[model samples]
Target: MSEQIADTAPLGHAKHIRSWGNWAALILLVLGAVVMLFPLVILALNAFKTTEDYNMTGPLSFPAHMSLEGVISFWNTTDFPMKFANSLLISLVVSVVGVLLSVLNSFALGIGRVKGNTVILLFIMLANMVPQEALLYPLYIMFKAIGLYNTQWSMIIIFTIIQSAYGTYLLSAVYGTFPQAILEAATVDGASRWQTLLRIVLPVSWPTISVLFVFFFIWTWNEYMIPMAFLMSDSVQTVPLALATMQGQHTMAATDLAAAALLSIIPTIVFFVFFQRKLSQGIVAGSVK
Candidate 1:
């Protein structure tokens, strides 16, 4: 009877301690979420509040009356749709073109070994070591000399090259272990190298490729420095630059600025909603088995 009571008391105490720990963890998590989301919450609140109310209350204050005037006024002042379209188009092209080149380049370097040409791979690695900003001026001069500066072609090529190099680096490690048995069988059956790659390798790689697509797309969409330096026309400017142009003493008030900021984030939110699953898979896809 005494031993049983001793065990029961300890078990009950442990259970109580665990319950307290769980509650403490939950409270901490809720606090952390509130801290991280506080700015966005403030932004959303101010976005809907009337200018008078926003000015009268602090940023965190609850709106007495919500109004669409801030959103409507923001839409009126800028070419929001056009800027969105530009970012969308650029991001799509960069992801697709860049991933394609990465796959092909990875195959060539990692699997297409013919003459033991390691120097090419060495050069690619060396290129990646240099910061892109270091090459910006030289690239600008070369692009200008070649009459490609300030063109969509220039942006497309630059982003494609930069993104593909990183992609190739990632994918080469995956393809480096291509099943020799399968390749040998394909070759013995009179299947050409291209056929084996197109049929077998590419199909197997689609998941990883999809991940790279999202990665490059997000980077290209958010890229500000390159576009700011090269893209000259206001019509061709991307969403980030367009949002930046909204700032000034006279141009945008607090309410309108908050509204525009919230609106700018909607497309990115939609993008994550669509790609979240595939992206999660891709993150783990390239890991060593």
Candidate 2:
């Protein structure tokens, strides 16, 4: 009876301690979320404020007087619609091209069993080791020689080429783990090389592909330097370049600049919010398999 009571007391104490710990963790999590979210909250609030109101009122305060003046001014002054279109076009094209090249190269390396495959893979990996900035002038000259300078195609091609190496490496590693029996069976069934890859290999690798798609999309969307260097036309300026232009305009208010910066992030935020579940599922599937 004494031993049972002692055991029961400790178990009760442990239960209470665990409950307290859970509560503490929940509190900390909520606090951290609030801390991280505060800037975005402020930006959203400030977007509705007039430049004067934004300057006069504290960042945390409700707009002393609500006005869409800032948003209106931004819309009127900036070529936001055009910039948005340019950014979307560039990101989509680059992501698609980059993923395709990466997947093709990775598939070849993983399944080909060619004698020099390792050497080729090593060279590709080594290419990415060089700093991108170091390659800029040479790339610029090469593109110029090819009549691609200052064109959207120049930016797209550069991004695709640079991004392909990393993507290829990742996809190759993932493909290497796939069962060899599947490939053998596909071959034995008289499936051509293209048919085997298209029907058998790609169907099973959707999760890895999806993850890579999202990664490439985000990277291309966020790319600033390449676009800045290669796309010189005001009409072709991407969202980041447009943001930089906003900074250069002397008359633009700081609040408006902040508001514009916040506006630029909205598309990416919306994309993630919509696709987050798919992205998470892809990640889980890739990691588990």
Please report the candidate that would top lDDT against the real structure. 1
* Tens digit per residue, CA lDDT, model 1, 104-130: 888887788736537766777788898
TM-score on alpha carbons, each prediction: 0.81, 0.86
lDDT of 2 at 249: 70
Q: Per-residue CA lDDT of candidate 2, range 1-289, in tens? A: 9999998998888766656779999999999999998989888888778777877876778887777766666666778899888888888887888889988888888876556878888888899898878888999899989998987888788888888888888888788777999889988989998998889878888767777777777888788887888888888888888888777875777567667878788888887777787789888987788
Model 1, stretches more than 4 Å misplaced?
1-38, 114-118, 248-251
Q: Which pairs of residues clash in candidate 2, taking residues 3 or more apart in a chain or in different chains?
A: none
TM-score of candidate 1 versus the correct structure, residues matched by position: 0.81
Q: What is the Å distance of residue 220 in model 2 from its true position? A: 1.1
Clashes per model (N, Cα, C within 3 A): 0, 0
lDDT of each: 0.83, 0.82
